[model samples]
Target: MLDMQRRKAMQKLALLGGGMALFPTLDAQAKMLEKDVPKWDEEYDAIVVGSGYAGTAAMLSMMDRGLKNVLMIDKMQYMGGNSSISGGSYAMSRTSIQKENGVMDDPEMHIKDTLKSGHNLNNPEMVRIMAYEGLDAFNWLVENGVKWKLFSRSGGHSAPRNHSVGVGSYITRPLQEQIIKRGGQQRTRIIMDELVYNDKGIVMGMKVREKYEFKFDRTFDENDNKTGKVKYYRANAGVIIATGGWAADPKVRQIFNPALTPDMPTTNHYGATGYTIEKLIKDDIDLIDMQYIQIMHVTSADEDSFGFGFRTITGGYSYGMMINPKTGRRFINEIADRRICSDAIFAMNEKGKNHPLLIMDVNGAKTVEIDALQRGIEAGAVYQFETLDEMITKFNVNKEAFLDELKKYNAYVKTGKDPEFGRTFFKYKDEYITIEKPPFFVTRPGPKIHHCMGGVRTTVDCEVFNKTGKIVEGLYACGEVTGGRHGYNRLGSNSVVDCIVFGRRAGFAIAERYQKMVRS
Candidate 1:
């Protein structure tokens, strides 16, 4: 009898559209119309709204805490979001990798570097948590089969603390495999083309439209013909919005951070828009530092190939110097923090300068991995010249001025003092690489929209707060979706650690609350 009734209700929904409607029962529909409350279609113990590093970390933590009915979803067809395409460098201190590399680093040093790089606007407690717990997160990744063998130095770090898995799939793939191994396909249901929520939000459930391509800049309009059947998902415990930031959304980027216009290309994936952030704002969640977007200090001008266009030039910059082609002078210290270098480049561009050249010698090229350098060269991003005159003629740089600058830089390299710019080398300081050795390599690189240090404000443990400065019950956030971990800028390689640390905290917090509720 119940099956018959359900079939009849499904038939009614099919009549209304192609599939399920808002409410199945006529009485429930009447109640919804009278009270104007959203009706939930399905329920789970917990619902995670992304599948990136943060979302996967949160799910793993929840599963560890004995939460079996947890559901993870994503708007994209693939599981990994921006994390899959990321450079896969994670900032972790005092890890086994650091110890094996014979580098002495600690959480205090990590926190100091992070705070300094962020210009001291970072939340101290949150920074402390991430710094202290980062090593454990690294260990977690290793224990779960993430093979990390290399440790390199990025822009703002005090030591060689950045650990890389070569590619982001090293972190994401293991987590995905673990999820499938533990719970099978049904355990992690990733729904694509689903816009999770709208204005009416306590995160009780999410309104999902199947086969719909969501527009990030605007709210959903029912009149759109391309949209598919709408469904709702309820969270019995809480909802975790681990969706990334708005780096790729030009409209939102222009509105919030006007300095980053639509003309500038982004390193983020297509799905790294502000749709979730917009929905959270409509739900009255407190947003912080929306205007503080960080641009990558170096990227290739060519868009056709992959090597240097979207790839972060951190390693290149760390091992090379940025020179203004027209003046043939080093404009900024290439080893400074990401924001400072990007700002310096922007300042040069504001003065009507050409795209700055990142020039490196053979030894400097040796500082980076050989395979990576070869890939960039093969992709036509990195140009190699046999001599100074060849480089000058090819790039149309002033011959005399360029040679003069090179002489001055070589002098500094010998003396181990960069008095002009006070540039400090994080690695390879003992054996400095001068640009005099041929063949020479150069690339015109500049900043592109990289990271947005802004989103839903949350506590140290990742519980989201409202406009009234009170915790919104049954709601949590993690990863790039929540802000305050970074302030005006993020330190190099810190994002992955921030995601893992806080994502686990959020999962544990929600699971504890749910367990307490069950006991009561």
Candidate 2:
């Protein structure tokens, strides 16, 4: 039986002192065995290697473009990957939602804000494409059954442009349904093992393992373990790599940023490893901006991972202000870029030996979803106090200093000038931006590893480039797998648009290439 052979193969690999270093031998072995092509057990018109927003978008776009036999796969048992639990906020411009909400925004402003947030290191063309085509991508999702509503503009955006579906599953689940309804096939627990390319260095297919069981103990070297049965799946058109970043793997994170030790908590799932990106690198693919791993400034100090606690941040950071419990003074600009806020919090926590408190009044708490806020309160991630005296007594803060700071902040909000930290406020009603209302809500948030802003380099069309700066034929990448979209830092809510925009573009490009090949 196939199962017996797979077990024997795994045992053989273990006997060979473990296949822990299987991928490191890729370069030398690939050259030596250049003539030996894999025997493919299955074939598809196009293959998408991930089930997150990017992969789902790619598959749907391919199907929309008349590619029927498209197949999508994920290494994990569950679909959507990291995107399933993400914040699910999409940043866009010129949307009807923004206009209805009296938010005057445009693609040009979105592009400018993105560049400023990334510190001008992002690929201008790629940013432009995402900003311009983002509306189309949003419309596509709506047409495909994603019911979106306007969320507040996240950090680093100048206008209220973030739209959401409550959570990432809302967006991913609907699109997945569309894929199944259209007869597109999706398989989970299928891990990509090796890239199968021809002699001319053109991708033909990929060697993968079906029913792959992820080992949590060896989180860093997940693919190094021999668990699943290896088989080849040929892609007639190409392989689209949508596998996400390596924020969950501490060892991999340390390779790019030594400061990101294992002690740091990450919002990513255990499956968000860099094996696919590492494999691409071994194959001489060009990887850029690997050093720019982003840390979320507003993760729950109470929760171990991503939870309802994030809703506290959605309300607190945007509508309220962060104050040091030890000093009872606002340290940095609360609504500044994520990098700025996170770094300041890191410093404050180290100095005070305590977590900073995010304080929001009733008006501010109104921004968060009611259900999520209630869940956060029940989960012990958020605390509510009817009076400032109650909060002061609970945190043992210098009550006078805290009260004085709030007064100053409210005055700045009135004048539209944050002289202390220069935090840009939302251009909405006073009650929404001011923190003067009673019945305060507070959350203790700390920085957690959130997104990796580095991976394989890609053209605007999502065509990947080799180390030699040449396009890899039949090989495309999108989502967190391909870098250079966000330069040093990625703005919040931009990841959704980035993934969908490029994923759709890559899907269309690959489908068009396939059609041209058929004609030829």
Candidate 3:
């Protein structure tokens, strides 16, 4: 590995290993935060909850601005959060990355595309801020050692607006290393179970607990295996909840968006249980866009039954194409908005017993690279099939019907047009000139819980607000934890930008608030 690559790898291991910044352990770590534990909870200058893009961004900005009392806390050992597991792609306007590549992008055009992608259901002011500040935030990533490259995505973005890691890993980790260097406290395996309010009804800090969703191996005798109790965690200060959305926790989804069953697939991280969001709602923290869920139509590497959706694309032009099991026919244009894509995937399962093929050809295959694939090779996107026939046999697609479809698709390609779906030639770069690529692979795209657009609603400055629009004193929010930015749907790779731009704003807001409050 090159020097930069080595540094990045070590940093990632640190995040996974839960040690110091850039993979180093401090001579003196911050009391484990767990030490304070369920007894004698203390305070800090700033307390960040949910170490996803937003929380980590806030942590860095605060520490960089020289806040000594800042603490970066989260439930996970690694700081990447869902952003880490994500495609690591983001849409930013006026970015040096874009201008350097001569993409001819502007905030206005980006706003238009974003709104169009969201089907005109976005909050105008928030969208405007997001677009305007995105480029600067992205540049910040590059400056802080984040390696972002260009990729076109499922969004109808004009200029391949997806900026992702040039390497396979997440782009957020390097930014996280910067935060740690600045002396922000990072604690993994911590979960914020409840919000803490001060004497004046001010949303002060939060009560954190250790938590783990994975069931423990049972040690039982004369009985069936028992699930081990999960861990608990806590954090107190001005708790900025950046814990992400409800996609993974189907139970939470079914509870809130009852129309959709939890059994529906999601590409979201397992930790994306939305425990904080649910409790906050119970606290009467009114929310917006709860019905929104970002689902994908990508294949899962684990199971041969191909019904899930949500494959993270590493590069190239790709989206999703679901097939009809009965007739082996294509259904739904692949490039729809995320929410629509998700809803469509689930609808396919609901209609076809949750069995459908998410199809992409040779060029498409090259583009679909989810980083976790290598690290989790035994279970990443890995599949077992030598030929297309083997895949059909293993996956149980209608044999003759699929063969007929492929024959027709191949013939249509020779004519230089996809008559079935007007995918438009140029739209798909390096188009599927042929589907005869050996190991024409396919897998189950599990419905993943990617992100939660709803959380603590905030103004442009990232200040948390009540139903009356009054700022909750000392409380601020950023990232997937905050809502009302993208309305019914989010543009591809926009949330990373959201976390950075708004996270800085929240950090600044907190810093300014702390300085003034302390002085006065």
Q: Which candidate is the best by TM-score?
A: 2
Ranking by TM-score: 2, 1, 3
| Each model's lDDT | 0.73, 0.84, 0.60
lDDT leader: 2
User: Model 1, which residues run further than 4 Å from truth?
Assistant: 1-39, 184-202, 213-226, 304-312, 350-353, 426-430
lDDT of 2 by residue, 191-289 (tens): 997888888888888888898998775244875668889888889999899998889887777777777778888888889987777678777888877
Worst 10 residues of 1 by lDDT: 25-34
> For model 2, where is the 10-residue window of minimal lDDT?
17-26
RMSD of each: 12.1, 9.5, 12.0
The segments of candidate 3 whose C-alpha lies over 4 angstroms from its true place after superposition are 1-41, 99-102, 166-169, 209-237, 299-322, 350-354, 359-364, 368-420, 427-439, 444-446
* Model 3 Cα lDDT, one tens digit per residue, 31-108: 122333354355677788877778877877776666777777666555666777666677875666667656677789
Reference-based lDDT, residue 192, model 3: 62
Q: What are the models' TM-scores?
A: 0.86, 0.92, 0.76
Native-referenced Cα lDDT, model 3: 0.60
lDDT of 1 by residue, 145-259 (tens): 8998567888878788888887787898898788767772222223322224334434455665555544433223312324555667767777787888778877777777665
